[model samples]
Target: MSFIQSLKSSLKASLGSKQRQVSAVPQIAAKASENPDLEKLLVIPVSDDPKEEQQRSHAFNKGQFLARQERWEDLSKIVNDEDQNRRASGGGMPIAELLCQGARADVVALAEHLLIDGTPEEARPLSEAISALEQILGEHSNNHVIATIVAMAHLDIAWAWRGTDAVRDTPARNLEAFELHCTRACQVLDPFCGIELDSPLVTSARCALLVGTPNAQTRVADDYEDLIDLAPEQQRHIRALGHHMLPQWFGSYETLELEARRTAARTQDIWGAGAYTWTYFDAVLVDPYCARYIDIPFFLEGIRDILERSEDQHNANLFASFAAVSIPNAAHLCADDLESCSALEQIQTAAQWIMSDYLHELHPLIWGHAMEGFDNHARIASIDALFKQGREKANQVFVRIFGEQMRKGNALIFTPQGLYVQQA
Candidate 1:
């Protein structure tokens, strides 16, 4: 059988005995191409040039392979090496962080399936895999690296049990399982929280664990403060804090504004006002009501600050993805709240300058999420559609922004190093 057919069959079989066909996520909506400008320029597509994605995936790939092979010691060595000395890839991302994330791929996939399908897998497959890691941890009780991995696995299992809908959407039984795993994740990770055992993964895990705690609202800022300080360069943590600051998660609009500014002040040396920009980046998109709370001038300045500080293509692509896909998409998601809608429009207009000035290369996976409203979890049916969605989004944006140049037969070719004009 063909790979897609085999995949579909196996996935269907894994959904338990309900007999209703199910998938990891909902089906992708067919978007008809309507832009006459879409054909104006030649584009460097994500699937066609996967080297950028591969650069980020190598650590995750290596880590998962070792894990599936039961090469626990080898995995431990990679973690330890990174823990002792954090290493950055050519794109300036911390390799150890990706390794830590990839280590839990097995359990995370199960949890993700549960989150998207809204059905419980009967065999409790993640339990068996987690137990193996726990056994390995028992043999090396002092290995905080393995403990971090174990803690992360429990966290993934916890989220799977809870699922990704509103609290009201989940059944009581699922909530019970979620709490049980979350509490265990907290306990397992307790030892690594000590002063001497300081690590970014541990800090991040703690920030995530706040969701399970009763005091998430009160402690969210403090936990994130420690994390951003510990890893100043990782603006993702700052981005997360903004989402958490929303009233639905941990804080109100007032609190979000305060925290964004406070974070900007604290990380000024590293991110400048860029910290404030990152903090508000996802907030407006995730919670449109929070848009008015953002400082418009400061936010734009930070966008410039971020690109000015880094020549690496990865950072550039981040803003590019946001400008090309995220803000434009956010504008359509607005139903009411004219004030919030107006704020999103402002950002959307600003996105043009980003496509024109800063964006040099593209990252397909990043753009994929950007195209799909930045919901990292599944919503699209086909796994392959992720990159395809990004390419289409990028093409549409390029055509609109560079239509004049393209109409004159100048095609823009993007590379990891720079953008080139191909004379036609």
Candidate 2:
């Protein structure tokens, strides 16, 4: 069988009794060419140096080969050993990525082994590997990439542990690990303020107070409650700022007006007023699939509002993670000389220009995320495929916007830290 076919078989075997059918890999591959947005979303960055690229390619392929052969022990050893070398070398790919790749591969091997051996003890090493990865990630409090990868690894390990005797016995340990991963993620990103700061003075004062306040425990509860009480309009505004405005700090009078109207209309719904509070997370490491919407003006605007509302009232630093997705060709929108085209094209052009400006302004933070490998092309493609179900049209528009941005090599401004526009 081909590599993709083997992968599908492995996934099916692992998810046995779960009702999900394997997605058609050929169909997914075909979609990229048929849709420009899809193509843009799938672009993975290649190393500039041919030698390094070849090595990475070879390593990944070799890892996959070991997985197919069901050499679980050997695969684990290879990845674990490589991880140690990677740390020592300080190579291009972050430690988190290396760990994740290794862990994911190891998990696949373990799953295959379990299918035959059915030994719970065999899974223990996988858990240990994941824990080791998390411990390393936790040590670096400021490294968002490591934190995110660790969090994801923890989640994966937790999922893998589920339904087993191990999980039933040590639920608290799993929960604690998961919580620690999230806590670390929050700490890594807290300085970036995943929400907009009305002004630098306000932001600075808030940060200072947070640092100085000796008894801030009582304030978290009140702040949480305040966030819960915000009107839908206020929440919507927060969401807008969280999603768009903060990512690029490009909100104009028109953008603000449109968001305000949308928020008002949505708030009129009895259930909509505070729904964003429950739905949005404080610190999310966005997947590639979710990253496509990062450049959409309306989407970013909504995210902004949500993030602002979620932050601690006294300090915007107590914020969520709005990490970017990595997909092929997923970048901020840019303008092109398509003025002679139809009216729709002209409108798209305008939107692209607006998005481009926003992304440019937030380049520092956004590029940082990309450099850390938080968002990329493959992840974006996966997200595009996943979200094409209920919100097909909206996601398609996002795909287009992202594709345009990628063509220009413009990094997305998808984090709150990207929103603070310094005055010249």
Candidate 3:
């Protein structure tokens, strides 16, 4: 049987009486079978009409191109126009692309105006954009794009407060607007599955509580606990190194404690699964820092451990994002001078070393995306240069770990089942 058919059979056996009722699996499998990248998996549904979807897709593509080109003003105009049309038609396209580029102040301003003044249909795109921008900013704390977006969020919030009489009449309206922005920020910055104590959202809620809102107090507590437990110790350690390396650069003790509590609450043990079947993944993104300090030995050891545990050989693929830096030097530098080399260069060198050492074993699974210091690398390098200075960089490295069973035609969605293997 095909992978999907096999998966369906397995799922049916696992679910027993409830198997007949589940319908999403087939649709998911079909989507994955058609597109190898799982692009549909990240899409947020906007409308059912084919024409609207096409227009929105075109607009999104244009917006992305404009962003890459640094043509912020033109990008803003196109998105605003598409958003307006979407409002008039009562349907729209996904706003992810627009939000991804809306880190510009003018873009955010235009989007905000459309959201507040346009039809009810505009609400969804606005909210999605707000949420996405907030999330991106939170994750890359020191990114200029993030700072710009946060500034815009604040500006829009201020404008809302000033433009309305709700501050005096219906305080809840103003509070809701502010809360949405903060919540988006929190969601973005918190680890994909971990609790976050330093989230601006949590902090804002606390402030609001001191000023009144008894219900928010309970929500704040619940959110805190949920964020903490999203990931356990090993995942946190592995992921944390991606943020910063030096112990001194890490967040304070209280922050770490809160995170630990939240993490403990969210973690689930999957060790009971006998031998995990292998599945291939399309990509594995890695932060430069992770490639630098943790990935090498950790990955090697992991491979060895998996082999020893399973006894039978299983193969999986890997993808990594890194910079290619060429330095002209003989082995004549002192230890302190070597340490002073650009962190980006060090990360690149380490990645090269790791790739070289594991080339024979990992060649099939390993593919590299070079960042000529223009894309994410530049932003991360800039962050490291400005704030931490060899401490930590404000950039994320995406890593996709494939299962041995995953095939080119197999559908892979970011659902609970896929996430289990992805996280592993």
Task: Identify the runs in model 3 with alpha carbons over 4 angstroms from their true place.
Answer: 1-152, 155-296, 299-424
Whichever of 1 and 2 has more lDDT, that candidate is 1
Residue 124 in model 2: lDDT: 51
lDDT of 2 by residue, 35-101 (tens): 4443334322222223333444566666556544645456545544543333211123322233334
Taking all chains together, the TM-score of candidate 2 against the true structure is: 0.25
lDDT of 3 by residue, 330-414 (tens): 1112224443234334433433333222212211101111222112222222322322221111111111223231333333233
Predictions: Cα RMSD each? 5.4, 17.6, 21.7
In model 1, the Cα lDDT at residue 181 comes to: 82
Q: Write the per-residue lDDT of candidate 1 for residues 104-205, one digit (tens) a residue.
A: 776566555545554454335444545666776787788777777878788777777776543448878878888888888888887787235657767777
The candidate 2 region of ten consecutive residues with least summed lDDT is 312-321
Clash pairs, candidate 1, are none
What order do candidates take by lDDT, descending?
A: 1, 2, 3
Instruction: Return the TM-score for each candidate structure.
Output: 0.83, 0.25, 0.25
Predict model 3's lDDT versus the native. 0.31
